[model samples]
Structures are given as structure tokens and as C-alpha cells.
Target: MFMNWRRIRKWHFLRLISMCCVVSLLMVCWEHVDHHVVSHMKSYSYRYMINSFSFVNKSLSVSQEEAARFNSFPYLLNQNNVCKDKDVLLLLFVKSSPENFERRQAIRSTWGNESYVSHELGVILKVVFVMGVHTDVTNSFLLQDLHEEHKNYGDLVQQEFLDTFHNLTIKLLLQFRWMHENCAHARFMMSADDDVFVHMPNLVRYLQDLRRRNVRDHWVGHVHRGAPPIRSKNSKYFMPFDMYQWNSYPDYTAGAGYVISGDVAAKIYQATLSLNASMYIDDVFMGICAIAAGVSPQEHVYFSGEGRTPYHPCIYEKMITSHGHENDIRYLWKAATAPEVQGISSGLVGKLYCTAVKMMLLCKPYFSNTYSCMAAFT
Candidate 1:
């Protein structure tokens, strides 16, 4: 009787262990299923939001005549006369005002200096300043100056649209048109503002890596996802309900600097033909068109959107672009591309040092907006 009782106890123990193992497996499977379900739901939500705002199909209420004019707009300034001989790898289109001559000159001397980039990096880079006509027609001197500048540099691409804050979309459209017509064969293209500072060495290296990997449909920069449109009338970014009813704009890279593959650029140009170009905000409008073209914008944590990134060696090591550098671009460029930074080893120890430096500098809350602060850390 004692032996039988002991055997029964052992059998019960074995059953219990089997049940526990089964439960553990079930829990793991459940967690995976839940994660997949959540991912699918998020994707569906984004698609539904985009479709909700797609009210018109291939019809633009905003000046059909102006839309038609995009294809045939004569270039008041052009780069075809100069860049015809070079097999360009990256074509940078900088959005500049007609009067920002000093800022343009600063850019030309620093990060936007194509000759320096090509000679140093051995990568063919072309820089073009995109502009529109001056709003005040009486400012003939500015126009004459622009003409002279273009004649000397052949780096300006200007259209007839009035250059104003509200007419930024026109400027962007002009860039797409010019890219399509002239530099479509380039491997990649970037749209940047005149005041922004680009780290040419880092950016060129990143693009070269992408090319080596044979990456396509690539659009990357500081991505803003689920960004709400400003509703306040007094806001500079005010969007009335009639203009955009959606609660969030499609994911878009910041206009301060964003890069797209040549194919993606062509696709965005085609998207412009079908979508209305009425949105005044160029970056957000680019997002809309990109979504329509089925191109997704990817986030690069190093790309500073509209805000200036805090200067640090760790930050500059991986930085791509920073905004609000109108006066300090040359200095910033010098610091970023210094020999010390270029020679930093990529070994584990060097990486650990940079990581520690970043933790010390970026772990704190900096920006007033909580999201912005978190993004800085990221």
C-alpha cells in the first residue's frame, strides 16, 4: 500500500510539470499574436486616415491652369548650362529667397560648396539654389543681381511665381519640375532650406552606403508622424477646416532637409500631376504627394528638423543636417568636418565613448514640447 501511494504521488507531480510547460508555450504564442494584431491595426488606422482626406481623385480645385503650367514653366535661372558634363550623384536643391544673397554666399563657401565636396569626398555633388520672382516688381535691382549671379554660378533655378511665405508650395513644385526635366538621372536628390547646414561628409557617406546596399524607394530625414494641423487663425501654420479636414498630416520628412532616391523623386513628380498643389506648407504637401505615390518617409534621428541641434562632438559625428544656421554655417561646417572627427575610430571603444557622451548631453529634457524633448534623446 505504501509503494502504491508513492507511485501515485510521482504521477501527479509529472502531470503538474506538463501542464506548466503547456501554459508557458500558450502565453508566448498569445503575446506574439497580440503584437501582430496591434501592428496591423495601426497600419489600418493610418491608411483609413489618409483615405478620409483624399476627397478628390485626380481633380484639383486649385487653379487647373496653374497646374498645367508646371510642365512648361520657363526657367528664369537654370543649371543645365553648367552641370551637363558631370555625372552627378546627389543634386541638392536649396530653397532660398531672392534677397538671401549673403546667406547663399555663406552656404556656397561651406557645406554647399560642390567643388570642395567633390575634391575631398570624390563624390559628384551639385548644388542649385531654387527661388521665385520677387513679389515687389519695382525691385528690378534684385532681379538684375540674380541674373548676374546665375550667369556667373549657373546654380539658380527660378520660376515666375511671386516669392512669399504663402507661395512656398509654388517654389517646391518648381523644384520637382526642374529635377524631372534636368537632373532625373542623378542617384539621389535633397531639398534643403538656405539657412540649414548640411554635414556633407556624413551625408555623402550615408548615401554611398545606401547605394552599396542597392536601396530603392528611400526617403529619409526628420520624420513628423501624426502631426496635427494648426487651427488657430493667427498661427503662421493655420489650416482652416475647408483646406484640410484631417486630424493628422501624413508622415513627412522635415523640409529643412530631406533626401529621396532618384526614382522616388520621379514618382513624387508624377504624384504632383494627379494631386492638388494647393497646400501652402511645402513639407506637408510633399508628404501628401509621397503618400499618394506609395512612398514612405523614414526617420533618421540625426536630421534636425526646424530646431537647431545642440552642438556636441557626439552629435556632430553622426549629424546630417541642422536648421537655423544662417550666420554660423561656416563655423559649424568647420567644426563638424574637422580632421579629429573624421579620424575617430569605429571600434567598440570609440563607439562606447561617443555613446557615453551622447547620454550625458542628451539624456536631459531640453525642448519645451515633451515630444520634441524625447525626440532629441532618440
Candidate 2:
């Protein structure tokens, strides 16, 4: 009886060890699955959360004194020679922070290289960085560095307002104000983020084509239609009923990079003064002003929105603007402007190659529902 009891006890101990091993293996598998799931969830939730925060912060009211200061403050730092040349074909305004010197420099060296565009393409492209004062009081040294950098570069347009995400609309207004006063004579104007990569050759070619076709009242980019404002309190683009009563926003181009005719730029500027500028979203506000001014946003597949375009020679040959290209701008510019690509004129074979590549790379099953190549220019 004692032997039998001992044997039973041993059997129970073995069973307990087996159970622990099973649990350990399950936990390992679960951890692997959870890592991927968590990563995807974070990426998916990041934009919504950021937009919600921006909306919530902007919803807060400023004091009477702060409002007065905001209204009365000037919106120019060094205007420089932005519009000195009346023969400027395209005026490129890049919205940058005061301390993003590396990004500005990268731009100047790559697609934003005005000298190269003028000398090589014979299209006068004036590039400037539009910015505002740094928000952090402790970052006084950074502000001073910005001042000196502006003095050396002579391409910064700064305002007196605090440079915060909630104040992006103010930045846009300042840009429009500058365009109205300083660079209105430019034939075409492009507003882009500092991180975007603008293919000057393609953009100039497109603009020149537009001029030949006499496409006036044009505001073209990646157009978002029938987009509703976020109602979630946790989203970065959340809009309260008190802030905006409209259920849907008017058709608007993505602010990442967009081009407008000089006339449209002036009209948008005028609309800003009359329309309510309480909304802090720069692109949405631009759309609102455009709607008020009777301008419609046009869709261009080459102009990317918040997302980056897939890189390929075929894609680059047609791409005008691609967002989120900080460190990769130089490489992309090189690839896009390669001699082989430049040599490929819009002929039958070239067109066929581009079409095939576009289908394979951009219109893949994975990219079908998302933003991808839609219509070829040719």
C-alpha cells in the first residue's frame, strides 16, 4: 500500500511538471504574437492620438490679453529677397521649425536647390523656410542659433507667435500674408513641409505644362474629399461641435505639399482675413479659405499626403512631391533625376515601361485600397 501511494505521488509530480512546460511554451508563443500585434496597433493609433491631442489643445480658449497679442503681432522676420526677381516662375514656401536646420539644408542641397533649378531647368525657383518663434523659453540658445542661421541663409520667414502644433493655422496665415505682400507676382506658389522631397524637374515640367495649357484657378495636390472631422476625444484631428458645426469638410488638398496658381494664392490670402481662423489645422483651414474663395482642389497622384511614396525609378520619374523624406531626400533626388530617367521622354516605349512598373509597384493588391498610382499623365 505504501509503494502504491509513493508511485501515485511520483505520477502527480510528473503531471505538474508537464503542465508547467505546456504553460511556458504557450506563453512564449503568445509573447511573439503580442509583439507584432502591439507594433501594428501603435502605428495605427499614433496618428489618431496625435490629431486628437492637437484638436483638444486648440479647443482651449486664450485669455483676452493673449488674444490681443496674437492678433496684433507681426508675421515677418527677415522677408529678404523672396520676390526680388519679378521673373520668378515658382515660389516654394517650406514650413519648418526654427531648429530644423539640417532639414532645411538637406532641402537646399536636393530638390529645393534654387540655383540648380534655375541654371539647369531655366525655371526660377525661389525656396524659403517659413517659421515662427520657438515655444520653449529654455531653448533661447536654439532661437539665437536660428537667428544667425537666418542671417546666413536669408531664407527664413518668421513670425512672433509661439511655434506650436496647435498654431499651424497661424503659420499658414503668415505664409499667405507673406505671399500676398512679398511674392504675389510669382506665377505659381507651392507650400510644402520641410520633410517633403520635391522633384524640381518634374514639378517644373508639370507647371510648365500647366502654363502651356493655361490652367488657371488651379490648386492641385492629393485631394481629400468627403472627409469628416474626427469626433473622438483621443484623436489628433478631433473637432468638437462648438469648433466646427459642419459634418463634412470641403474638398481640400493635403498640406504636406501642394501647388496653387498665383491668383489662387492671393484669393486664399484674402479669404483668410474674412473667414474665421479659429481652426488650427493648416491644411483644413486652407481648404476652408479655398472654398470661401471659390477654388476647387484638384487631385494629383504624384503629390503624396502624410504618407511616403514607394521609391522606384518609374515612380520617381512621375513623382512631384513625396512626404516624410528627411534623411532620404538626397538619395531620392539622385535616383529621380538620374540620367536614364531624364533621357526617357514621354514616348511609346517609355510610357509602356512606366505603366507596367506603376501597375506592378503602385497598383499591387496590397496598395489597392490605399494611396497609389492612379492615372498616368501621358
Candidate 3:
């Protein structure tokens, strides 16, 4: 009886200690939990309860006079003849920084090679590099090199604004406005960062199939849905309360690479004319513009979401674009486009083998941004 009483007392003492520890932990984590977890819960609830995103349209729209300032920058290097009077299938806009000459050149020799697309893929794809003048005064000498590049390739489209992180919205404006003025009739327009590796052969075939079906209002990429905004000031992608008080942003695609039909491109341009472009993050700004324009982003399994894909033949067989491939783009382009890759998933034995391999590579407890677990079964 004495021992039983002592054991009960010990159990109560341990329970009391555990309760205190849990309470202390909750107190310490309350602020972070409230901002990230509670805010997202509230925002997602509000998102579904609303009828339409018309409120976002009202909040982001500005007067035409105010909007004109965003698009009024003069072009320093213009390429009016890049797509003039041509049956262009795809107009690819590579958003390159002023200093990434090697990346641009690597792309041109690899996936951005227009001659290869025309001869091998049988599609007239126009590739153009869009950038702004260097912001740093000490790097002024590079302008001579830029001028030489423009003279040689005639594919550089630059504006007068400084190329900085905050000016990315301005660059986005440059792409849409340039397309509006020059290549509005192209069947599809793609915007991609210079580091992204695009499988041109696969992409050309996909676009050709869409064209044959005359698909309209199509915009496809790696889609982010119901994502909460980062309120932490230290974060590079921080969103202040004054700028965007909403807890969640509308669905958007990763700006690393995405494709929009010509009609959707025109819609986005018209939306840009009235919407305020103060959101410096180009991909979020794109989501805002798309919301205002009533175009929804579609998710493609093969498009990467801000992460590099595992180097594998099964992955290359269906990949449209993979992000964060600067150093090995040449090697990936060579390996991914090899003639043998096309037959890796053809027969019964091949399909089962590739599916198992993809499962091993893609299905993980942690997030793998290349493709989802469902991709393995598919």
C-alpha cells in the first residue's frame, strides 16, 4: 500500500512537469505560429468563401495615368525584326541579367538554338534575351560589350531602367509590352530565367498538339495555390502589411519558366495597362495580373518549381523545363535530347522499370520540387 501511494505521487509529479513544459513551448512559439499557421488558415478560409477575385482587381487597379509610368521606359536595344512577317510557333523570352553573358551564350548554343528547333522540331521558334542597363556605375564598360552582342545577334531587347531586384516588375512589363508591340501574333509566348533548361523538342511537340486542337486561354507551368505571404522582414520575399495585407496570394506559377497562349498573353498585357506593378516579385505580380485578367494557371507535372530535377533518362523523357541549371545546361541538353531517351518508357518492361525508378527518385518524405509522387505511378 505504501509503495502504491509513492508510485501515484511520482506519476502526478511527472505529469505536472510535462504540462509546464508544453505551456512554455506554446508561449514561445505563439507569435510564429500565429503569423504563419493561423494566418494561412484564416486566409484559405476567406479565399474559398469569396465569390470571385474581383476584390483583388479593385485593390490592385490604378489610374491609367499612374499605370503609364510603369510602361513608359524607352527601349535601349530593340529588335523589331525578330518575328516580323513570320509564321512563328513559339516566342521565347529569356529574362537574363546584364552580367550573365555566359549563361545566355550557353542557352543559345543549346536549348535556345533556333536553328535546331526549326530543322529538327520543324517549328519556327524565336528566342530573345530581355534585360535592362546595369545598375552599378563601375560596370559601365559592359555596355560596349552589350552593344556588340546586340549587333551580332540582334536578339537583345533592353530598356532604359536599371536592372535590379526591385526592377523585376519593370522587366516583366518590358516582356509583355514588347510582345504586344512586336510578336502579338505568335501562337505561344514563354518567359524563362536564363538558368532554366528547356527541352525544346518535347516542348515543341506539346505546343504543336495544343495548336492542332486550337486550345485557347491556356497558361501552364508549376502552379502554386493558396500560398501564404511571408511577413518576416528578414526574408528576401517578405511582404509587408501595408503593401499586401492579405494573408494568402492568389494561385501563381513559378516564374522560372511558364508558357502562355497568345490570347492569354494579350489579356495579361491589357491587364497590365490598368493594374499597379508595384509588386517587385515578378512571379507574384504575374499571379496578380493573371487574377485580374481572369486567366487561371494550370499545373504541368514536368515543369519544375524553383528546384533542380534529378538527372535521369526517365525524367528527361517528359521534362518541359527544369530550373536551376546554369553550369550543366550544356551537358543536360546533350543527354536529355539523345535519341535513345525517347524509347526508355516505350514497352511493358521499360514502363515498369522507369516507373519504379521515378518512385525511388521522386517519392520522398521531404518535398521534391521536380515532380510529385503521383508522377511515379503515371
Q: What's model 2's overall lDDT?
A: 0.77
lDDT of 1 by residue, 197-303 (tens): 89999999999999989899999998877666766788899888777766567778889899999999999898787566667888988988887678889988778
Per-residue CA lDDT of candidate 3, range 316-367, in tens? 9988999998899999999999999998999899999999999998898987
- How displaced is residue 50 in candidate 2, in Å? 26
Compared with the true structure, the alpha-carbon lDDT of candidate 3 equals 0.89
Q: Rate the local accuracy (lDDT) of all candidates.
A: 0.79, 0.77, 0.89
- After superposition of all CA atoms, the RMSD between model 2 and the true structure is 10.1
Query: RMSD in angstroms, all models?
Result: 10.5, 10.1, 3.5
What would the TM-scores of all predictions be? 0.81, 0.78, 0.91
Predicted candidate 1, C-alpha RMSD: 10.5
TM-score between candidate 1 and the true structure = 0.81
* Candidates sorted on TM-score, descending: 3, 1, 2
- Best of the two (1, 3) by lDDT: 3
- Using lDDT as the measure, which candidate wins? 3
Q: Model 1 clash pairs? A: none
